[model samples]
Target chain A: MSILLNKDSRIIVQGFTGSAGSFHAGKCIEYGSQIVGGVTPGRGGTTHLDRPVFNTVEEAVKKTAANVSLIFVPAPAAADSVMEAGKAGISLIICITEGIPVLDMAKAKQFLKTHAPQARLIGPNCPGVITPDECKAGIMPGYIHKKGPIGLVSRSGTLTYEAVHQLSQKGLGQSTVVGIGGDPIPGSSFVDILDLFERDPQTEAIVMIGEIGGSAEEDAAAFYKARMKKPLFIFIAGKSAPPGRRMGHAGAIVEGSAGTHASKIEALKSAGATVIENLSEIGSTVARNFKPVVA
Target chain B: MKLLEYEGKEIFRSLKVPLPEFGGVIDKPAQINSILKRLKKGPWVLKAQVLAGGRGKAGGVKLAKTPAEARAFAKAMIGMKMATHQTHGQTLKVEQVLVEQGVKIEKEFYFSVAIDRKIGSPVVIASSQGGVEIETLAAEHPEQIIKKPLDPVFGLLPFAARALAFELGVPAGHIASFSQVATTLVKLFIDKDMSLLEVNPLVLTPKGFVALDAKIVTDDNALFRHTDFSKRVDIEASPAEREAKKHDISYVGLDGNIGCMVNGAGLAMGTMDTIALAGGSPANFLDVGGAANQERVERAFKIILKDPKVKTILVNIFGGIVRCDMIAEGILAVLKKMKLQVPLVVRLEGTNSEKGREILDRSGTRLITASSLWEAAQKSVAATGGKI
Candidate 1:
């Protein structure tokens, strides 16, 4: 009942011959994801992890009927891989590659808009998404996630893992955990994932982890205020970060007063979402805010 | 990376954009004569080459009516210390000065092309209320700024540029030249993989529109394609930050006592926030990145130890793609090789965390181990004599 991915999802690994693609694709398979085939431009007709490899995404899709494409291409070619997947009619594309230029992503966004409007691109610099025990399509540690009712979305990788770890420790498992990435121009937004989480019947409550960045968090706050019906808890990191310096992530920069932590926290609080100040307080706050949903 | 004014102008010139005649860079007072010979005539502008913005108001820019005045200004500016609001009050050393022919401005217009993250496209922002403060213009006269989002596929079309120019109050006679400037700027932005290309006060002189000031920031990630431009990266970063950059790690120097090293940028920042929440300030922010192998961990440790203000070091890592035991080994190797004067707090989680903990415990080093981020922050803060 999770959104975007589940047991029926047939995934194909793009850049399958690379070290990162093969390694993580094998791990995803170990966690019960349906990885049917792979795509590597010149390495077609070869096989990796006992799956057939094709030259292009179109060939892979046609041969194996792959519904989703997981990208592990390097930064220089990652955007083209995304465009290739979208043009090939792959509905869901999860890009795990980091360091893609912002201009390339800008072009890819436009390309997707005109070429494949139905395709949903998750991240160009993220850990991808997972539907708990049913399927995994990212670099997240598989053991930490458990199939349950809570939905989680974040702009971070390990921070999402931290939230999931705390939630699992508190006996609250997840329905789906989506890492929308920390890039300045991500394919999906907080509002986009929030809309999906709200529609998923299995998701009871949601936890959003955001940081100092663009107005995505503020926009999400506005969306929640206007349309959301379920309870949501949020944690915005980088409160102690100095202004003007990029705090690790490319998108996590405090330019003037636009992306400051104070403004984001204020926006979320005024939108009726309980914003936790400390990272360790996320679990306790979420637990206190929501009562158990009876089956 | 942020390019100096001269470097940005050189890029614009290469792309055939109209700019003020160059008088060359004056690295020393003696070079002023050579620069003056290259210029057309009198009335030159001496601009200090510093990475910080708002140089005009900070007196980093000066106008000289004669060659002697230009030489004197260059001598005064070179080897001087200047501070700007962008630099957060930190004084930057001016190593070079740019001497250029000053233009008679009939009008000033603000024009910039930058990747708009909100719209997921490249946007060209223009305003007739040019050279005054762009931030103030944006804040007060939002309507005065006309923004046009450019299509990456076909780029900014002539009609679109004409519309933007017309809306920006470009004179009917000057719209064609303005459109040419806009089209060239957009092409430069795309071809150069620039994150930002700004021409503040694109002046309209008797000769037509000329770029009076230029600021171009190339994307560091896309530097692979621009090999020649990558060599021009500014040397304004701190030594430790420069070293981290060499190793492909992210490091930002801070004024605190606890040196925090973590994997993943978001988690690194979260670790810093947690350290502050535990009543301790962080000396710096260092992200060893996702693949924290032994070499990277060792390099990160060296960078952290280079800061003399650090009294305690906290290594908080959540191993997802990175193995925890490998990081533990790297730490042990660093401790064995170097004479560490500060207390070290190591917290490892995720893959092979138990093995990582066992390795650290068996190393017989004087190190504090924590099972969680909170515990690690508390230990590091207490070790640094801070209340938790």
Candidate 2:
């Protein structure tokens, strides 16, 4: 079974009237997501892509019995959407929007600690999650994904696609793929997805694509060292990026002390995971490292 | 984007943080007299405001004893382009001359609070040996650097700041002063939504602590909150980069001419390296994202065409979420709108891949689709008829 989403999981879309929300929600629906309804504030009671719209998340949840909420609100309102979804008793809140202020995320994180401690947050700026061959959510290209044993997760959007393409070329399909996004203060970390992959029976091995930012990679390394059942092949981006130049990813910057490509790579290497620097090397690195027994 | 010292000082001043008196910006030779009238002090610092490092050694910062010398210094800086590590060309950003009484440096100390990606909290780094490069100091005198991790939940507390200050060996009474600066810096950093806030050479003056130089780099993603500072960005950046931004393509100008265009940042960088490895130089690093429309394609092509050195255009798109036909449409649109002259090579894969190639092949703008990245680079280099 997939971790966050599956065919039976009912979901609601926040800010579904917006272009990104509608476009992705339509695609998710086409891929057989159980989109019970949508919430677009003033556009409530209306319908988007044949799903009923509500003004507030609470109202949508009460009516639709939606267990998960996918938020596609703009940057400024993304944190509020997360809080709203959490307060509405939705267990899983996936934020697909990018660029929410870190301060906002900090405040929202505090709120989540008290209000919705049981709820799981996939991202505040992530591409959300997809249980391959089960259910799809977020804006990932749906065509390249196929059901397999490898669990793929990344901090980048298109880079994940690139990794999946290479994996597909190698005849390695995916169990699920999650884009954790590039925001400075993302809700979920690599370890969170790693735990999910470890528990999922279908996910035998994982391909984690991290970038040059944050200590999340190190945290994931710590997790790997402590007790990860599956073999993991990881690729960290922005190795050649100059110090102080924030790579295209918002979170990928070498500032103060923690966010650098080298530190992340060193940490992962010491943790017993095979670390591949280049994107092209991810598949080969994984293929060579993973024994058939792991799958 | 990083702001110059003067700009950072202006932001500090706006936040009601105390700073030394400053003079007006002098853009012309004639504006020197007025700048002199604005300065209350005799000895002033003529600092060139360029977005780069090593400005101090480039003769960008100098002490002028007289107003005439300050004016002359301003004149010398005006219209003179100075290159720095952060800048590519001679950046003409010396808008005004800052005339101020230089503070007496009792000791150079460093302090900065930024997002620590490790714990996802604001990390405060303080060192007794400040002013110089912290990296160097950390390597040489590792004991001098003090690392204090801040809790995102509780924020940077006063006790934590004082403890850090005490660890840095400040006296009992001076701990309060250091704590004040630390707290103020943390506030300013969080309030401004800055990605980095560095006070190198935080000097110990007779009056109190004074910031000798401040370096601030804000997160471009959070620029929407600070429109005033956003408007002040240097518009003189490479034309292609600016144009790519307009169409939402992540583009950075490099000194090459293969005009490599790819669909992802990782793929784009990989493509750039593959080109370089294949003896072809990439003109720029352009990531059109996984969703490339005709408008973005036309914009990418226009930006590529703007580079006269671009002899061949290499378009490599792994069409998964983004279809190949859409990429082909964008390429054709760019070719048609720009009236195509450069030889173009493309490698399109995934999602209606063959149909996309058919569209490009039928376009007749000298398009060639290679089977792999190596083939695409070889074809692009061959099409250029020389090493790019």
Candidate 3:
């Protein structure tokens, strides 16, 4: 089975009446996703994109048996919306809003752990995920994706699209692709998705796209070196960008902890991951690594 | 946004955190006498209020034993062009000076509250040995440093604060005030939406623990609620970068010969990497975001061309949510709006990218088009005569 999403998953839209919510939800439905209902606080008993709208996610889940939530709530209340979905027992919450306050996310993450232990959150500023052909739960362009054995995870949206399009060009299809968001704190880490990708029998190889930000890539490398049995390929962005170098930067500098591009790349490479030298060559590199593929 | 020393101290002052007696702030040397008149001291510290760090080693900070000395130091500092290791070779002009009463320091310790991404929470970082070279201290004597992770939601609790003060060996009589300092730091950190709140060399004087230096960096994304500090642009960036911020584009200036613009942040960074690998130094990192329409692309081009070092421009766009033909039209419109001296290499991909490429090819401009980022990087670098 494809990880996290499939044709059987029933999805509901939060902030369903908003322009972004309505537009993307409509696109998801057009792509053959099972959009059963929606949740907008005041506009219950209405119909959006031919789906019934409920006032609360709890009510929508109870009535439609919706297990997933696609949230397009604005930044100020985006974290609250995620928590609301988590508390309502929605197993998977995908937030597409950007510009959320870091502390607000920290609190929302804490709430998710303490109150809604069963729920999983994906992004606050990401492109979302697609299981290709079967389902599209995010704002990603759906037509370019094809179902295959390659599983992908990234911190960026368009860059994720680039990898997928390149792979699709080389006749490589993906089992599942996820954008875990590029914020300082994300709802899920690279390891979180890697765990799922490794266990999915359909996913034979994994492509991880990371950038110079948090230590998530390093953490993932640790997990891979110890536990992963599948082949892993990786790319870390921002290698050419300047880093914040200052003696005063030690203000926040923990003793030996760093998230520099060199450190992330070196870590993953040492962990036996094939580091692509050029971003545009990711598809070709994976193609060469995976032999006898039919185009 | 990074807050200057005086700005950070103002927050500390408002929060009632322990601080040395404030003499006053002055921009001119003549104004120093008035501030010196109010403070009770023989020697005062004249700190140049420049955004650049490493002030002590750069002569931006000086001690004045007399009123005349203070004025002289202020005169020398006020309008001084400061270049530090942190400024990326750019000079930061000192426009203000802060005067504070000198205190007898019995000991110095490092204390800070910052978002520790590794631990996934805010943490209390302290060290018995602290100074300008704290990083050096960390490398040599790691055990001297004490780091405690705080509750991400509630912040540092009282018992945690008490334990920290005791562990740091605060005097039993002053442990309560030390705990108060810890509490106020977390309070200000969360309330102000600060990414980092650092009080390096938290001095222990006969009076009490005073934050001798305060450096605060607030989360730029959290500025919607912090409208008082509503400036989302980085104050420390170059002039062109500040201009890009105003136009809602992500731009960072670098010292290279080839300038590049792309659609997304990660892709923009990757473009720079490709440029570097292709034997060209990328002059800047610029992302026009998903909606790279006519006006926005035009603004981005103007910003990129401002740097005198940028000899050639590379435009890499991967149409995701936005269509390729629309961006192609935008680039064409930009060419019409402005005259270009630098050679241009454009690469378009994703949705309807072939149509977009065809539009550019037929536009009759001397623009080179590439099918991929690798080819675009090579062409742009070659256009620079492979000199870089």
- Number of the candidate with higher DockQ, 2 or 3: 3
The fnat of each candidate, in order, is 0.74, 0.30, 0.59
Which residue runs of candidate 3 sit more than 4 Å off their true CA positions?
A: A245-257, A292-295, B231-234, B386-388
Error of 3 at A66 (Å): 1.3
Q: For model 2, how does the per-residue alpha-carbon lDDT over A215-281 read when each residue is reduced to its tens digit?
A: 7888899999997968889887665455545555677666546567778888888988877755556
Measured by TM-score, how close is model 1 to the native structure?
0.97
| DockQ of all models, two decimals each | 0.79, 0.34, 0.49
Q: Which clashing pairs does model 1 show?
A: none
**Candidate 2 versus the native: TM-score?**
0.88
Of 1 and 3, the candidate ahead on DockQ is 1
Runs in model 1 lying further than 4 Å from the true structure? B37-40, B386-388
Q: Taking chain A by itself, what TM-score does each prediction score?
A: 0.99, 0.95, 0.94
- Ranking according to lDDT, highest score first: 1, 3, 2
* RMSD (CA, Å), each prediction: 1.6, 3.5, 2.9
Question: What lDDT tens digits, residue by residue, belong to model 1 across residues A7-74?
Answer: 99999999887999999999999999999999999989989899999999999999999989999999
Candidate order by DockQ, highest to lowest? 1, 3, 2
> What tier of docking accuracy does candidate 2 attain?
acceptable
Cα lDDT of model 3 by residue, A1-295, tens digit: 7899999989999989899899889889999999999989999998988899999999999999999999998988999999999999999998888778888888898899999999989987888889999999998889889889899999888889989999988988999999988777788889999999999988989999988766888999999999998899999887776656211111212123467788888999999999997998999999999753333
